[model samples]
Target: MHGSFPRLDIGPLSEYREDHFMIARFSDYVHEHQSLVFPHRHSFYHLVLFTEGSGRHTIDFHHFQAEPDQIYFMIPGQVHTWDFEAGMEGYVVNFSDSFFTSFLLQPEYLDTFSFFDQDSSNNVLKISENVRERIGQLFEELLAQNARATHWRDDMVRVLLLQIFLIIEQSDAVDRRKSAAKGKNATVRNFIRLIDKHYDKVRLPGQYADMLNVTPNHLNALCKEHMGMQAGELIRNRIVLEAKRLLINLDLTVSEIAYRLNFNDNSYFTKFFRKETGMTPEDFRKSPAI
Candidate 1:
């Protein structure tokens, strides 16, 4: 039987302090973790722009060929693992949502980034060679500013990060336009955003339908059309994902995770976990591999 997936709480390579919001790297991270980066999910967002590489990147069980000038974005809870040849080079930026939301004037601005698409379908953006030079500079500055703390280092890095996002948005405008269904898919996007926000306390498709001001049937239809899954399935998937993250990374017990995720009883949570993952929570925790 298939078992549970384990999340690497500490980054496979490195991490800043818990309270700190972000970290960026150019080539050092890949060089340090020369071995396999175990299949793991992060609690923070991960953005990578590879300038040189040849191999594969596995995201949510899908293998994407590794290519230079390609960028990959992963939000929380998506499982990823990568393998590459000896001399791959890239820039990686890891951030917590609170990092920008707490400081930026527009707290909800992140929702507009096409790459962070909740369903993770368009997460990889292939960049052109012309734009690579400028993008690489942005990463350079972020690395320089983060190297040593000055009076305004954090603020400087924050501003630079915003610039990087804008550049990517501008560069990817054509791609977004190609698949853009702003009028129709907007509702589905809103539903996914809501699922990310409330999956723990609200799991019913009807609840999400009400939030979107559409009938449950309509909502399910839209989800199937856009995501190839029902709205309810997405909600349950999010909840189970968070549960798995907490179970594998934290010191919390099963009962504590059950309550944290709004399940009233441990038994029901166990049943739900088993139904979704094919293994009991205890068995999952004990497994040597994901």
Candidate 2:
């Protein structure tokens, strides 16, 4: 069991240089009582390598069981929470988005990797013992170089980081090829990715369809055919998922949450929420599963 921490806000990027990389071993302080890290979002990407313990990692509306020898990559701007049992060991590698775009953003390079694609649903990357040893060594080298102030230290750190991503790229190629062959249409996949990226602001199906250069009807038909649900259903699910997350994870009032979700009238939001969920917002918030 893990106790929740106060909501943590990781601030936006103040600098844009890709010269520095932050690597930390979380095992030093995270224990049973300290198992929960506050929900936070960062401007840079994070690669978390979990070596032991079991818990749930919640990112946006998605939740996954965390286990040993697993790697979780979180892109920029995704709010996430880490809940773990005692005695967890891991390396957290943090780098600016510019670092990736500068070095690995080529079409051929990106096409060779699946993990970086916004359309790919493969969030958790499993690591083999041999690969883990190699990654661990790279991380140690990064930490050592980052601690030094030599003129060539930054260059060395950047090179090492690139090497790490290159290795991941090779391993992720097979997965990407499989995903591409799955043959989901680009429009639907792009729409889903847009929703994941901008759902907080863009909630209307017509608006999304317009952005994708397709009619609302066509978009709805495609989603229903491929996902077994209409585009409207997908939008509503995202909204409700965010609502549930806010209600359960924060101390915000129902009315406040309704307003934040863009409901002009709090009562209307409550009614709509209950109509879909079969429970009032307040009652749903009080449920034990939360």
Best by lDDT: 1
User: lDDT of each model, Cα atoms only?
Assistant: 0.74, 0.68
Model 2 Cα lDDT, one tens digit per residue, 152-207: 88678778876776676556323655445323567777787678667768888999
Error of 1 at 152 (Å): 2.6
Using TM-score, give the best candidate's number.
Answer: 1
Measured by TM-score, how close is model 2 to the native structure?
0.69
RMSD of each predicted structure:
5.2, 5.0
lDDT of 2: 0.68
Q: Give the range of the ten consecutive residues with the poorest summed lDDT in model 2.
A: 11-20
Candidate 1 runs further than 4 Å off? 1-8, 11-26, 34-36, 172-174, 177-179, 182-187, 197-201, 211-290
Backbone Cα, N, C clashes tallied per candidate: 0, 0
Model 2, total clashes: 0
Model 1 C-alpha lDDT per residue in residues 1-290, reported as the tens digit of each score:
12323345545534542645555454676665554365677777888888885887776645788888888888876777777776777788877767777687866667667777554557887876667788889988888888877988888888998887778777743275524542247788788789888988888999989988999999999888866788878888888777766776445789999999999899999999999989898987776433
